[model samples]
Target: MRLAALLLCLALPVAAQSAAAPDDMARRAAAQLQQAAAGLERAGSARDRVAALTRTIRAYEAGLAAMREGLRRASARERTIRESFEVERLRLEQLIGALQSMHSSPEALLLLHPSGALGTARSGMVLSDVTPALHAEVEELRARLEELATLRALQDGAAQTLEEALRGVQEARTRLSQAISDRTELPRRVTEDPAQMRRLIESADTLEGFATSLASLPADPAAPDLPDFAAAKGDLELPVRGTVRRGFREPDAAGIRRPGLLVETAPGAVVTTPWPATIRYLGPLLDYGNVMILEPSGGYLLVFAGLDQVYGRAGDVLPAGSPIGLMPGADRAPAIPAAATEPGGQAPDETLYLELREGDAPVDPRQWFRLDED
Candidate 1:
């Protein structure tokens, strides 16, 4: 019983050393989760519940992402340990047999050697050296087994946490939609003329044409002044949590190319405004899904295509990090099991098409947004 307790005590440190990265990630994710929950509670009385809920939703996303990564790493480590054990199975068996024979042998027989006194003395010295090494191997094997058990426990616990995060994010999204509907606080940059907008939408045959026509519309003289959008180059955050699947002007599977980024995102993921901008247009256009056109400054248009739902109204001036829309897809399930099946949890649920234009001419968005390398 004492030996068993000692093995378990030693196993903890060994497990921590082996799985340090994953364990650290899990701890960070847990902290994020707590932050999200706290944000949700505080949003009930917050002056800007929309912004608070936005932060909550983002926290949930970040937490879920980190948790998924940790689980993936843990699963990989577990597989590696199992594989190592399989490769050393024969050697382990021999070691165990040797230990068992030493333990069960009669003391008199152990001392008695077939050879003379000199041979017996030499054998005793050899046994003294070999016994400690054999014991060390046994302890290591026990440690590995304990680590494997710890990993399994961690994975099991992660399922509940993932589920909680998913539900929390969904609740935050629903509340954000409600808050947006209830909101009448944001100032309009321009009072949109229905007839003029209809005429422009009907006449434009291409995105460039549409953008040029939209630019021709008069700006509100009383609109609030904002910081220069040009000065924000290389410092802008992406509107959503996603990976850039296609770079600017990069060809797609059909060999067609566009002067924009194609970002892959999870289903129902929240999309935000990367910077303060006036909504020039919102709704469906051409082959694109639901779209949003933003004007951060004169002669500049930031276009986001392929949203499932859009919030706010045309001409509404929104602040940076404002919830704009969501990517189309069903809610994610508790992803612990999925992490094992699909490590990294990066399966794309939808694609967001982003375009930037200056004077209706295309420019690479990568020059502006701070995209991390995959």
Candidate 2:
């Protein structure tokens, strides 16, 4: 029922412009956007404004993504229906001509066949079957044409809504960023030593070395203990929403294997901490782009690399699902290319490198993270 209401809202005109009837996914997009808007409205009153704004931004992102996929489906379906209609065009024209001739012919003349009475009776039986089949084919063709038109109109009308959704998500992201910068509620797990952090980053030439050095740093004596990391094995969520493009120690194009999982996500997607953890390091290191190293427990580190921007600071303890960073890219909603919008198109543009380490040894992150596989 909620979906139906959203669908009705999607069908309404914007700025005196009529909207096309939405598909199921389009209806879903509408609902998600509505939810995001509601979240945004209530964010000012929420206890944790950053979390509320994060949720709003995520909702907007999900809605925009759905709308994009819906447009792609509509385009593909329209192309298919148009192709089918063209293939049947000549046959349909001939059938229409024959039907018109038969309608104009005298009733007795139509009954008389070039054969004897027995043959005429058989011919009548065949005509009775063929007539219904022909009518059905004509009806099917009509329906396909109508569907094609609807799809085409849907793609046309969806552009404005897509633009609005994109703008809304961007605004939400901006608000979330500001909120995070102003946030100071999280506890500090360690005292940051600029010199020590600089030495670790400058002296280490590899991820393993950097991670090992970070682990040797001391935590504050007064810091509170976090939940057991080992107990959450196989139940932790991925830091970001994406598909695992490569598994742990998986070989790349050059056959060089890394002890991490490569996750492909949409450009500028949000990255969060999946568990309560303290930030040990957050910056560019080695060849792993922008990285955020977290110590969820003693001797256990979760590393997220390839971010566009990092949030919070070293030693700040974050609760689960806290926005830690964003994947590298512009915040604008994607204008998917023709090939990408097609069925079974290329994967998303950005890739995040994730690794879990226990006492300086890399472990299979898939074993710890519950992933939604492609």
Candidate 3:
């Protein structure tokens, strides 16, 4: 009996060790998962930014291409103008040659007075009538010459415009394609009915009012778990680097207060998320163009709108600074110098509207985004 009892005691320790092994492994696995989640968030943010820049760069390049095409059309018109002027020049030259031939050699035969006083009087009358006609011919020739000079200048201007468009194309294309390695991989956390969400979005009247309804929606459990949203506070980078055109809650021309921020950026300026979050909705809303909403935390939703084009859809897990979309430039805005565009390109006259909501209550984005005074 003692021998059997001793064996049982030994087996118990072995069993306990076996039981602890799985628990220890599970704890380690959980830790690794958290760490991987954080890493994914950062990588996603970087990729998102690249995507945004790519979108904007493409828009700028498209504009340059259109301008070049317009320039080509203008050049064709200038060529037509030059051809017409050439014909006018030849006609004027022929007239001058004929006039010179008639007047180049003057004979003293008339002054000889074969018939005396009557012949001299008739010659004087003939000279007076011919004088006015010569004056008219000279004036017509001078006007035709001036028209040719104007046409030449017009052609020169068109050439200059074309050359400028050509120069912009290479630079814009280079910046967009430089990062060939970076590609976006937006993970689908959960299957969402985009049509359903968009319908819900349309039903709401105001941004603040709509976001309140969105706050109640359940989060995707399968979403890659990332770090805390508040951890990025104060140190949060602006989604897109540009000049702040309007402050949050600032009154406009009619004295109506704006609840969000207006950032003026180059056409095709890349916009990224400021925190790890999931995209809840992406589509147009009222006067706001293409809109995207990111839920950074349980109750907070970040709103970005006035985009020329949008990226990703609902249920996408995005890391901080991930590219979501682009700020629009004027569809036909003139090209500004390189100085006008940052490492990016020239900003369009348009503005990106940014609003933050905590369960439907509007919060000043100025508090969230770092901005310059005034």
- Residue 264, candidate 1: Cα error in Å is 2.5
In model 2, the runs with Cα more than 4 Å from the true position are 1-22, 103-109, 115-123, 336-348
TM-scores for every candidate against the unseen true structure: 0.88, 0.87, 0.50
Among all candidates shown, the one with the greatest TM-score: 1
Q: What would the per-residue lDDT of candidate 3 be over residues 1-374, giving only the tens digit for each residue? A: 22223223222311011112222332343344333334333433464545544444434343443433333333344444455546555444545554565466465643335578887677556545555655665664465445445434543444444344434433433333443234347666774567857766778897666666777777677677767766656666667656687788888788878788888765556677878888888888777788888888777888888887666667778767666775665344454333222333332346788888876588777666667621
State the TM-score for model 1.
Answer: 0.88
Better of 1 and 3 by lDDT: 1
Note the Cα lDDT for every prediction shown.
Answer: 0.79, 0.77, 0.57
Once fitted onto the true fold, the runs of candidate 3 whose alpha carbons sit more than 4 angstroms away are 1-184, 337-348
Model 1 lDDT tens row, 309-358: 99999889999999899888736444554545454544435889999988
lDDT of 3: 0.57
Task: Give lDDT: candidate 3, residue 230.
Answer: 65
* Rank by lDDT (best first): 1, 2, 3
Minimum summed lDDT over a 10-residue window in model 3 is located at 13-22
Error of 1 at 27 (Å): 3.4
